[model samples]
Target chain A: MDVSDILAAHEAKQKAIVVEKDIPLEVDAGFLTVTDLNPIDVESYNEDLEDYLLNTARDGVQTLIASLFQLPVTPSEDGPVAKLPAPTTLLPRAKPLPKPKPLTKWEQFAKTKGISHSKKDKKVWDEEKQDWVDRWGWKGANKATEVQWLTEVPKNADVDFDPSAQARKARKERMAKNEKQYQQNLARAQQAAGSASSSTPNATSNVQRKRELDKTLATTRISTASMGKFDKKLDGEKKLRGVKRKFEPAEVSSSTEKSHNLAILSKLDREPSAKKAKSGGDDVLNVRKAVRFASKGKGSAALARQSGGGKGKKGKR
Target chain B: MSTFRAFILTTTVILAMLRTIKPKNARSKRALEAREPKEVEDPRTVIFVKGTHAGEKVDHAMKELMALKRPHAISFSKKNTVRPFEDATSLEFWSQKNDASMFVLGQSTKKRPDGMTFVRMYDSRVLDMCEVGVEGWKSMQEFKTAKATPGHKPLLHFASDLFDTHPRLQQLKSLLLDFFNGEIIDSICLKGIEYVISITAGPLPDSPSTSSELPKVHIRAYTTRFLSSGTRVPRVELTPMGPSIDLTLRRHQDPDPELLKQALRRPKLKKQDIEKGLGNKKKMRNLEVDEMGDLRGRVHLAKQDLGKLQTRKMKGLKTSRDDADESDESDEDEGQVRRKRRKV
Candidate 1:
């Protein structure tokens, strides 16, 4: 069989089989004619259309615009349209500007004239003046160059005048003068040394003799009052008499008095005792005896009056 | 015979003793035999002369001079006899008569409120004539009753303005310092008195003919006693006088400029060489670090390439095993499994 006839038979058989099966049919088929489909009610359709336009149509348009522009859109409460955000991604963040550098005088002039500033050259040394010179700019080459001729050249005056011969002559004269002075000083020093050496021994001997004389005189010296011959002999006699008197008896009884009178006679025969008395060696007994003999009667009356009058007057009262 | 002999001996002894005895005058003559003469010392005298028109300034000056305790300071008060700044001959004669080596003459007039005091040393050699500005003079008189200690030195103060304004004052101050042997003090305790002396010079009044003559010297002296706890009232008075000789000799002589330059010049500083050594050290250190880092980087890169090659060989072996397994399965089945895996 041809392919079309075979396919038609298979379709027929499949349809028969489907008819034989109890497959339920749809309760309502889709509309077959234009009239069977209800005509759109103009009034109700118009009302729904108006409601959508009022509620959500504007928001949909805003969303469409936002999406097209790649903007983040959010719906606002009071209005149907969404708000448009600022395009932050489109513009970069602002940064602070850098500070401008201060301009120097030369730099300011150069800037006004639209010229770049150039560096100055290093200073050069001037040989004649022995100093560094700034050779550029408005100061215009140090004045050292103009005064080069005035600098002294340090000429050799010795070669021109031959001063070595004159110097040598003056030095020889000074040497001769110095030699004469040295000789004189040497002679003077030698003479002084000789004189000093000679005088030293004489002075030493004189001092030694003086010391010996002083020692000898110190032992042999006596009192100035007894330097006379007679006074010396009398002093010796008085000393002898003092020695003799010590051996006599302590009590001056008549027996001892007779012996003392004999001793005095012996002293008077040998030498005078008056010289001893004048030399501050008077006897106390003799002095008392002399005083008593001179004022005996007069002293008794005065003594009696002085002692009895005051006592007798007090007794009478 | 024995009694007769004793009487004769006693009479002879008495006669001899009386003859040998010397008088008191003869004894005194012996004492005068060996006596040395005593030395005599010359007296130092400073005389104070009160001149014409001198009111109380001379009295105040005398008090200060006494306070100084100078060796022999004598005050001569012949009010109408000697005039202030009179001829030098009279002063010379007066000084010679008084045996005074130094003289201080004081005078004050209506023209100068501050009194004048002239100090002359070595006869007529006038040292200075200065003003003594006296304030509270009456109060100082009250303090005269109070006694100072035996050797207490009075404090001396020179006002700073006196030194700055008057050149002659500096000269006078130096002279005073020398005269006092630097014993003048700058300050003192409240128990003692403080004397502030200022000296100045002005034009001479009557003698306008001799412009070369020394200027009229004026001295202002102030005296005050400080209580332990109270404000002090100082007595101030000004004195003016003229000197016989020139005062220019008191100025300090200037030194030679060339000698000063030689003395004050300083030596130049030498340059240092350590900076070059330090720079070389830094350069050597940097070179060492660079060489070390380059060597380390070469080794690290070689190891990384070796590791990458090993991983690539391992991946190649895995891909070959997968190719063998894929060759065993049907293309359609493998495709469907891959699709299922992708869907899962």
Candidate 2:
């Protein structure tokens, strides 16, 4: 029996099941996606763009479906079911990236002063109990001194000076201080948000973005030779808002500004000398220290030259 | 509490006064609606505030930090002469207005230099705050490397036993988690993970030290890169994405009991969410997800009698008295073997 015709048909069916390409289509089974990295065939693309795109899409889908079938399936009541892996494709998010939050009042100061936030534990190690205990709350370490068995009374204690009561009062004051601060923080946050929302909405919009882009184009236009003086103007083009250079009024003289600059210079000169004098010596009695502030601009050596040992002896005495 | 619980009456809460506000305008209505309790809460809004005095370093640190919080963060460019410790009215007012629940306050002074405070807000109220001093800082500019995309959820790595056991470090860990946790999401693409914020404890005390001192905190930010490693999972490499900071913990405030309780409250969990193993239950009946994203369900049945089972009628099935008895015996034996295999 000549079954060669049947064998050829079988081979064709098998070949169709297996995708063969110069650069095999990259199939991400996780995302059920196939990417064709191979360069486009210019001959086919130029001939018929739509037909080429359709074929390309079909091939991608075919590859993806083939990969999906390759996944291991389990028998179920309905039939066999294949499980998919986690997606690998990165999809664009719907919302814009979140903006960094504003600095809190405390954070601003900390940043400027170079303070790192330190976490405080809720519990503290108690040396007396030889164990860890709550810093505050029921049976906390803060109330330890109040519960001490032995209490010593100071010789100058008031008649009604209750040591435990005094300690409790101080602790209560600290709690009051914290409560006050918490209330204040809440108030500030509300106010900040209220004022912020008013302006934030206007900051970004289609109209504003278009206007900004137009402004950039206008600047680039005027940046050419002759500063756009000889450039051809386009119809319906808005007037350019270029920066206007300002010159000092002809009426005003440089003398007024000159004095201001001179004053600044003099202040700068005096500040260093004053600072030097303040930090001149380790002690107040040092002659160099006294000369800077106490004396009328006289050095210790100069004072000695004027009064010899008399001035020095008087200072000693 | 001691025998003398002075001012205890002042701290007591009156739950009766909790008011329900009906916003008047469409804008306000939307704002209030967004703040409504949800099974999945929105990414917390953070407001950056400057104090009476802020230095160049503070500005740079904020800029680097802000780079990570864009779109969800608001920065007050104008310097305000507000002191949080002395007065917190401004913070509360801002929280209510902006709907911001987190804050980074930067302030520098002669007494407390280079101070930063992280304030957590609950229902427009300060839940807790922790202050730290920046001993050393390195902004993103110094690294000259690519940074993580702003607003991407950060992979927070707290490499310290203190975070789990110590109370103070635990607070910082949770605070940082909320600060960097951009949005609430269930399933995420493994490749979507971008940057990591690593915090390692500086030094360990060989012996217990005085209660006054705390070990310094080192915060390092990195952009993660996945390189092919000839395996299903790729090898991860960390590139320094800066604003690396060294910090020493200072003054901290613990949330009041009533306030902390409200902060920890979560919306009711749905049955489907619980079935996904979000709750304490380790196993659930029937419906479950098997390998990858496939969902599977078990359909149970009692033992079946194979001899009486319906089969396609064929000429061979019409057993004349010849092999009917033999075929019946074979079928029974097969059924018994099947049931035994199922039991095993």
Candidate 3:
């Protein structure tokens, strides 16, 4: 059998077998269709017909017919097409642009123009306006220049002028004129230099001396006042120590008297005759003298008043 | 009445006669040109004339200077004044380089970011301290009643008498205004003053070039701040280019918005996006890539094959010529789109 017939028969048997086996018959339909159409020319037949039908079908019946028949059922094309012929119009054609004018030779040469002067001849140009400028001093090319002096000129003045001799003569005259001026300047400068050094030294010394005096005077005044304060304090301390020492003498006298009284009492207890003699006339006489002196002493009050006045004056100082 | 009319007519005639009688050579340009090269003292020099004290009136100073009948040439600085702390040699060098004029009198004023202004006046010779009226301060402390505590050395102060005078003070104030106002026209005048000074002083070869001078002016402000223990260092730089002075302070305790607006304040820093790191981190980071650099192999390969079919495209096109042609058409459209985007 031919390949198409064999493929189709195999697809039909497969569908029947699918039905018998309780599988869906639609599942084998795609396979059966492919096998049946394998030998047909797909490009010529429009194989996308199914896709078009699926896209366009609105009614259920139309969809079923489109699917069964496998016919294209898409929407109509949007518009009809056409072409128009090319048109032309009258217009001016573009023209080539003109070239710019070239710079002149004179203009180019003027940029490099120079002015020169030599021992033989001199040529000065007017740089601003480029041209062969007349040397205000130039007479003619053959004759000597106007700057060339006429005085003391040689027969061939143009060729024989000696600039060195003229220069030397000028220098000699200048030196002679300047000689006096130079000497005056030298004297003035020497005087100024000497005065400057001397005055500077004197000014510096004066300032230094003044500074030294001021420093010494300030220090002396300060130290003297400070020393005075110190001396006063030392005198005060000495006076206080002297008063304490004087009080010590009085205490010693009082202690000595107490010791003597104790010794007399012990002697009286040991010897009756000694005690009687000691207690008798002389002892009584001393006691009476003591009482009398004590009674008459208004002098001590006067002395104490005098001493208080002195202590008060010391306190004030 | 006739006599009165005659009197008026006579007077008119006399005036007309006077008008017609001018010196014969006065109107000639050649006459004037001949005298032009003669070194004559500038009659217009206005120095201190009346009620003169030191530093009070520039006019007064000029008048005083003119009395000497000295044939002095004047040059102006691009700035009103220069600081003493600035290297003299370098400044002279820059001034000469820029073809700046030099003068006997030189001055400079610096405006701090905080809006405080400091002015410095200079001279080739030591100025008479008492003559100038203000005792020159060697250090900042000498600034009278200064908010910032100054150090030990006394700073120079402008003559109080000068400041007190209405006209003198007004002129100085106006000068300050011009400076803060950013008047570019004044730059020539400033430089002219320097030039005149240099010419008068004779030749100084060490003058700095204009290019060098400009950068120095800009950089000096920075270096000057570094030397000072001033507060509030700038976070951004504002390059101001205008005729008006940028009066705004970069730092202040309490910012005055009106002042800032008047001063024409602008920020100098540009914020760069941090998210750029995240977006390009993984894909390109492995090569430690610099996208700006040339990629030789990728460029060569891309440029070499014009109609090469991609592997994915081969499968997708089903090995068909029409499909390949359609893909190429899409590619060309994409290329056009890319070119347009690139232009944007």
Candidate 4:
């Protein structure tokens, strides 16, 4: 080999032997390597040996002298400490561990959906949880804080946390939102009303006229079957209205006959006639009187006519 | 001697008249007719089964009622002459059988004109209308902060003394309240072996203005409470017991399986379909009847055959087939195996 190549190889050997002084890396392998090699502080030993010595020179001579006084070396009771071999210049370098990924803005926003980002800057209240949360980024600003929104709701900020009151606040906010929407709708309706009033003068009157004309047109198309029935009904009604509203003379005559019979019965109970008693001896008289009374609607005139041709039957006494 | 005899006779007549006028009118006659046919709501009925009209004991009446056959209805000439006092067994039986919602039985020393001691029963609801006793405890607020401190000992002591005065009576009242679902109860009245209890099941509270809502009931419970002192306590006022009804009750409150199933059926379905369903149920009942008829036929035949076969050992003739078959059926039903089957 050339002199320059030999010099480069020796420099590489010197660099490999040097180690950083921090928590140990590659602890699984049988080695004890340390940086800032103050030879007095750290001791390196072969793995096969039972005994080991710690280098106390780098820590200062006070530590060395204290150790030389031979203070009792009490090993740890947990597990045996193994002796590690000294690091050589030819040892390979240890690999580094992989780094963790960073969170995106969407993920950060999701976490704050139902929680307060910070307690110090309490502005907008988390309506769902009824607690204060960050307003964060609103109103054309980047990263507006909870402290700003908090000024908007002073009454809420001042009150202590009460579950029932919080629920009321949420309800009030919801109602306010609805009322705002309703007011907007009312304004729109009022605008429309103003525009319509200015534009149209007789829109409703025209609509009414159209409806009346349509009704007249509909009435002209009646079914023939229904029209015939309607005509017959009207004729029957007129006849009913024209009829005479009085009782018949036949009915009056029957009532008079009933009254006359009642009067005769009353007279029979009061006084018996001598002529009638004498007539009782005849069988023909009984049969003839029975036939006269038994006839339907038997009136005195009809009986009189049947007995003696509309004249008095008996001779005058 | 005539004057002395006359004086004695006059004295005797006056004594007899006084005895006849003894406080019989005070005892009211029990209306038995009111309790029958249609179930009465707490008709105070005093049933006097047996025992002498004079000096009739409540125990004797209770015994007679217990011994009387099931469904024995008797009418007495002296309706208010005999009475039963606090008879639990008869009270329970009458409550169950007669559907008497409330009952109270007590002995009254008041005798009738005929010198007969009588017992009286009253409608328990009368207590709700009329004040009975005093208030026991008012509200829980008094005991809310009653920690076991030196000052609290005196209050506890007072309570202990009150409990000690009537331990058994209080226990009995507690037991009765438990027996009848925990009703907002009033005092327990004991008028000569008569115990009248009044209970008002308080209304449940109204629910919030949420979609899932509950009913609201008016709390008009006029309840009285008795003190530890046996004497009637006073100063306990109450609200009106109100009408004994729930107006805003849901119709068909519970879905009766049979009724609900019938209601769910097609409205277009004819009455004949319903009749068919009922007829099927009746036919199932008739199948059991047929089985019984077969058993009776077998029993009759066995009895006839047994009589004919028994010749030498027919002196006693006690092995009746009717009795044997009945006993066999009973034993089999009771899970007792039969040894052998007699062919007869």
Candidate 5:
């Protein structure tokens, strides 16, 4: 290889190995290479150049004015003020049209038929008089048929007049006939009973008469005062007042009386005998009396009798 | 010998041994993978048999059972006979022939005025019968199974009678638990039904320590039915009836106790403290603190300025320079008037 070729090869190797620090420059170079520019026609190019020069000069003037006054510059030819229409005076109000009258059904039909005459005028036109007559209160040709009750009444009408009165009269007659028949049956039954009782003499007739009496008694109403005694047999006998019995007092043990005596004697320092007698003498005496009474098997009989007497007196009161 | 050299030699020998052993393991694993794609077994079949005295109730129950859509379940009617055992044996023979895992025998008798339906569910696997007498208009029973037997649990859905008034439901529940060999869990799911007993092959789902453990068998018992208006006989009606027992296997999960308790507990309403602003005017006037005082002073100054502007004459300002000031003053007056009207 030649020296220049060797030097070029070494430079190429060094460039490939070295990293590029300017990323934007490299990207711009790559973009420039990748993009293709087409040439415009001479006439269009001249027109675009002229328009760009004019717009730049105009925009520069607008921007200078905006910066000087600190206000936005109004664009020429199509500004807001130029586009808006000039204000004009308000117009006078117009008068409202008159309302038309509502037509009746007959009048509406006449109008549809292209007739000019009113319904009243047609009804008033009298041919005999040769002028419009006052048709007020005058019936039309179909006036008689207009009244719903004007039809003929048919014969043999199904309407029943005073039905309630007729029914009441029939009911009254039925009740009177029933009452007369009931009276006649009662009289016949009484006569038959009297004849049978007079003719029969057998014992069976007597039994039959007794049965008839029993049946009549069963049907008879009993008084409320006698109702209590009606079922007396079903109820048991009434209980009598219970007798009051006396109970014998239990005998007091001697050990308890001795302990009581000892307790009383211990408390007495000056006179032991008097203290013992005063404190526990009554209890010991009562115990001896209870034992004597219990041995006889009839203790407190007198007390029981006294209580019973008092109870009897209270009951009497 | 040096420790490093010995360590290197041991490691090389171990690596060489592993290299030789890995191919055999790989070959065996490949064979297992090839054989793992065999077809899974189909779910067991259910057999439904109608008893001799089965009437409209049995037909209704049969329709409800069919609606459950148990895998390959079939129904058949038997000759009228009083012996339930004979009928059961015949049903068993037919079920065995058909390869059915469970049989539901329905017998309704006229002996009970409330129209009691005697339902006996026979499990071929356990060789046991779970008999339930459904009485009254709204008697319902629900049976749920966990992952034990796929077709063993009878499917009963949309039955009209769903109330748990029948005394025999308890007996039926015990029989079912015995057949499944599962622990019972009392559930407070519905009214009148005492339990939501679960039969799980694994640990109980409700136990605190083992709650994370999944249940293999879950049986839920409850009654649910639709309501109807009018006095028409509830019988022969195609309305929703239940006392349904759902049997699910492997789908049982632990229910949140706290959430359930919160749901069951009555809600406490917060008492609203309505500030009527009765003392607001006094509070507004007595602004002693710095933050409120500054705001109050500003308000007072604004009020005084408004009063002064209201009393001042508009004709006093006549200079052209004061034209802008006059306009601003007028705008402020208008704004103050608007604010006063809004306050009023």
Candidate 6:
């Protein structure tokens, strides 16, 4: 039997499966991507860029498919599915890196003094309780003096001196001072960021600063007991321009507005929170309904008096 | 009198909404502050506004776009009495109130019928705006098919050289990219990619390109299917998902150079990244990230003579006592032969 014809056919079949290229394709199976870094044949590319691009894309996809077929697979509902590993490509963060927080007053001082920081834990060991508890808060270590039953008094101390009350007053003052400093630091940091970011548009940033300052001033002015309406007008204190409120015209014929209102009503009707509030809670029985049923529509007052009388009778028994 | 009363009835519900802008209480203040800019930014919220004379087509197109943009979208179904081209103060007001940075305004005036403007805001001010006229559209509702989950990041495919070459088309491409840009993710799962939006341009005229208007832009959405093709590798196919639209470029505005520069600014790279050869022009020697993103390195050593290297001791290969002297002589002769040939 002649095997030459069979050998030629086998050779042609092998050639169809094999891929020949100068540079090997880099297959990232995790990402399902294949990158071919081989230099382009400039003559063919210059002839027709679109056709060249298409051929290159086809080659890449073909390589990717070949690599994918070699991967280990598990039987899935749809068929055998090759599970893709987590992608290894490093993507740049979409937003800009966060700016470091501006140093607090104490932090700045410590820096100048070349002092290293050591963090203080929020919880501290209490010797009396023999357990860890909050350093400050309800029944905290800081308020130990205020809650103590007994206290040592100085020989020269006045009779009216209440040590517990005095300790509480001191703690409140410290808290208020810390809050004031925190607000100051926040304002300073915002100003720095605003100026730093808007360096190119110096004039616009300045305008923004002026506007922010005016807003703060207005808020502070109206924050008084009189709401700034009855306050004495200071010299050259320009009037604060408030946001104007404009309503739609009375004779408006637009169907859009009507439809919009209807939409809002429908949305509210569908709201779970509003429904829950109206029904108090679906999980619990309605007290009003229970009272009406128990008293045969006598109302909650009758139920309340009956419950109180029942409690009194139980105590006596 | 009845019409006047009707206006009051309509205004009351929206009046409650308007009151929410200033943050009357602590809870409102907290809610408003949640929209503040973060270090890693959240996806931008978008507001859709309807013009006084918006047509049915314009409204439906906006509605379908809104469907894709939900969870971060706010809709104003009312007819807004504002022209963006003339006065952008109204848009600014809406942006500030909602803390939204993007807007899709649909209007159909007699002068510019079937128009849709995309207004983008930066720092609560109008940065750049562009308007496109709607030629025709097919809403998502019409297509009864499996749809992509709302707010999923979509793969955008631009199918024309004009998108890269033509200025107007380039701007349109940029606008569309920004509009569809969702959460930033480093890696995506194969199955997670549910849909892709393909944008193609109409044919350009052969002559007098400058005088003629730019070609129409066709936007089509498709769902991807990975069919098992007898092998481990699956065959991919695209099925049509709807909300297909055709747009022609209209009035456009370029962003300010200074503002654009500020917007494009990138943070400084970390020292570790630079050492890994991820810098512009200062790559470290003998380092590379492999295809799997693993760091690969090369090492160098001083050259050595292979003949002088030690080998495992063996009874048969070891030289005898008398052969050792002969072997040393032969080694010297072999070394001298090379030098002798050089002298010759």
Best by DockQ: 6
The per-candidate count of clashes, in order, stands at 28, 82, 58, 9, 28, 0
True contacts kept of each: 0.00, 0.00, 0.00, 0.00, 0.00, 0.04
Ranking by TM-score: 6, 2, 1, 5, 3, 4
Q: In candidate 2, which residue ranges exceed 4 Å CA deviation?
A: A1-317, B1-28, B189-191, B207-212, B289-344
Weakest 10 consecutive residues of candidate 4 chain A by summed lDDT: A89-98
lDDT of 1 by residue, B134-208 (tens): 332322343334334434433222222333344555555544433322221222232232332222333323366
TM-score of the first chain alone, every candidate:
0.14, 0.38, 0.13, 0.14, 0.14, 0.41
Q: What DockQ does each candidate score versus the true complex, computed on alpha carbons? A: 0.00, 0.01, 0.00, 0.00, 0.00, 0.04
Model 2, B63-177: lDDT tens digits are 7777787777899888887777666757876776676878899888887788888888776677788887777888888889987777565655554446556678767866776
Candidate 4: true interface contacts recovered: 0.00
lDDT of 3 by residue, A253-273 (tens): 777989988999997656456
Candidate lDDT scores, in order, read 0.40, 0.66, 0.29, 0.31, 0.36, 0.70
TM-score of each: 0.22, 0.43, 0.15, 0.12, 0.18, 0.57
Docking class of 6: incorrect
The sequence of per-residue lDDT tens digits that candidate 2 reaches over residues A1-317 is: 99998888766655554556676765545433345555455576558743554455444444555565556666566545556553333321212233345676788799999999999999999887799999889999889878887788899999998999888899999999888877877788776776567666645654687889887877787677556666778898766665444466766568988887899998865645555657656543556556765445766665656566454334531
Q: lDDT per residue, candidate 6, A1-317, as tens digits?
A: 99998888766654543456786765555544344555555576558743554455444545555565565666655455665543333222223345577998889999999999999899999988999989998778899999999998879999899999999999999999999999998898887777788758778877998999988988877677656766778899987566333466777566977888899999866646654677665436666677789877878776677776655344221
- Residues B84-138, candidate 5: write the lDDT tens digits: 3333444444543554545565555564221222222222212334433432121
| CA-RMSD of model 2 | 35.5
Residue pair clashes in candidate 4: A19-A35, A40-A55, A40-A56, A40-A57, A40-A58, A123-A146, A123-A150, B24-B111, B24-B112
Error of 3 at B198 (Å): 29
Model 2 lDDT at residue B171:
77
lDDT of 4 by residue, A69-153 (tens): 2222224453222222221212110111111223334345667785445445536666555776555334312133322434244
Model 3 chain A lDDT-worst window of ten = A28-37
